[model samples]
Target: MGFIEEFKHAYAGDETHHYHVARKQVTCLHCGGEDFDRGSALLNTTGLTFLRLDWVNREAHLLICAGCGEIRLFLEKPDRV
Candidate 1:
C-alpha cells in the first residue's frame, strides 16, 4: 500500500461513522467518500512535542475517510449524521 493507505490503517481503531460539518454531510475531499472514522488531532507547535508541552496546544476533531484516508480537521466537533 501507499503512504496514505498505511497512515490510515495505522490509526484505524474507531468504528466507522457518518458526520456532518456546518450542516452539510462530510465528504472526503480526496475520494469523494462519505464514510469516515472519527479521530482527534492535536494542533502541535514546532517544538512543543520535544518540550513535553504538546498537551497545551489546541485540538481539532478529525474525520478520516474510509475510502481515501483523507483527514479533515475541525475546530469544533462535527455533528453526527
Candidate 2:
C-alpha cells in the first residue's frame, strides 16, 4: 500500500484527515498542465522520537497528466482537516 492508496481509503471513510507533503503546487512545473491524478498521503516517521511522536504525517499526490506525462503535487489545507 502506498500513500496515495491510503489517502483514497481515508477519503472514502471520512473527509477530515491529515496528509503530509514536502511541497505544494497547483500544476506540474515541468509540463505546466492542470490535469492531475490523485494519490495517497503517506507519513514518514523516521525521526521525531525525541518528541515522543513516532510518526510524522505526510500527504502526497501523484498529479499526473496523460497528455504530457507531467507530475505535480496536491496539498491539503489546514481547514480541510
Best by lDDT: 1
Lowest summed lDDT across 10 adjacent residues in model 2 is found at 10-19
Q: In angstroms, how far off is 58's CA in candidate 1?
A: 0.5
Best model per TM-score: 1
Question: Could you tally the backbone clashes for each prediction?
Answer: 0, 8
The residue-by-residue lDDT of candidate 2 on 5-80, one tens digit each, is: 3434323322222222444335456766644444455544432344344443455444445347554444443221
What is the total number of backbone clashes in candidate 1?
Answer: 0
Model 1 stretches astray by more than 4 angstroms: 1-14, 47-57
Residue 6 Cα positional deviation in candidate 2, in Å, after optimal superposition? 7.4
Model 1 Cα lDDT, one tens digit per residue, 1-81 = 221211222244656878988898999888889898887755546445555656663555778888888788666788877
TM-score of every model?
0.66, 0.38
